[model samples]
Target: MTDLQFQCTGVRPEPFGAGPTLLFGLRIEEADHQPVHAIALRCQIRIEPARRQYEPEEVGMLGDLFGEPDRWSSTLKPLQFAHASITVPGFTGTTHVDLPVPCTYDTEVASASYFRALSRGEVPLLLLFSGTVFTGRDGFRAEPIPWHKETSFLMPVDVWRSMIEQYFPHTGWLRIRQDVLEALRRYRSARALPSWEQVFEELLATADAKGGD
Candidate 1:
């Protein structure tokens, strides 16, 4: 069996990607410095909230996901961030590769919600690695990578913010059902609202007036 080890060096935003993506720099090493033909690697990235501390503002925002901060000792658990796969070319001793992790801005996602709650800090990540390893020089041999093969990384919040800014700029994203969207559209059309911003402003004003009365 080949003794393989993994390490996460750094992460960066993919500027030209079709969607929001983070490319994590991964380093792979063989203890015996044996020749590796190739590796079909699968990685599961998880956000470990318990690994880091949170701010009051962030805690308030994360209430919907983890409940009150007082009970966070038990509520804080690993949040699944992404699953990525890569095919590493043949190498000897050691090699480096980029693992592309696709991301989403949908606040409904637990990972996204946790990310949004953070003001400024690194996101604690636990990367679980698996899949097949191809080795041997004369003849090809396939072996299953153990589930215990994993690594941890600290991803900067700025990297995530910059990636989101590249796509959404200063705006945030919201997902609504088709029926609810139709109703909003109807409301906007009835008032001749020029933009969705005005529609929301008008609705808030109306609610405020009702509350005052």
Candidate 2:
């Protein structure tokens, strides 16, 4: 078995991706100065909400998620953020690699809600790692990645917001049920609406007229 240590150096949003994605820089060091054949890596990221202080407005924005700040001691626990994997190329001593994590804007996701509630500051994160480690000189050997392997990183909230802004740009995403989709389609067809925006704008006007708030 090879003695390996993992460290999360930093994270940044991908300039271009099919969806909002972040690239986390990871460094893997092999003790005893041995050569590594390759590593099959899996990382589970978590948000540590209790690790940082929040501004008054941020606390208000997060009330729905965590309730009043007074109850945060019970509610502000760790939340699973993202799951990512990587295949580390062969290296000796130490090597660095990128772990790409795709993100969602859907408010239904606790991680998404946690991220959106923040106006500024870093998000404390814990990266729990596991997988198979392969190494050898003449013949290859396989070893289970230690369960205790983990690293803590403070990710800048600006990076997450920047990725979403680049991808959405003055837009927001909504997730609705299939029944609601059918209803919306029927309403649009009945009104001969040219686009979903028109359908929504008309609906908003109707709601305003009815004082629906």
Best by TM-score: 1
lDDT for each residue of candidate 1 in 21-75, tens digit (9 for 90 to 100): 9999999997788789999999999999999988888888999998988899999
Q: Candidate 1: where are CA atoms >4 Å away?
A: none
lDDT of each: 0.93, 0.92
lDDT of 2 by residue, 28-106 (tens): 9999767889999999999999999999888998887889888999999899899999999999999999999999998
Please give the lDDT score at residue 191 for candidate 2. Answer: 92
Q: Flag clash pairs in model 2.
A: none
What is the TM-score of each predicted model, taking all chains together? 0.97, 0.91
lDDT of 2 at 98: 94
Query: In model 2, where do residues sit more than 4 Å from their true spots?
Result: none
TM-score for candidate 2:
0.91
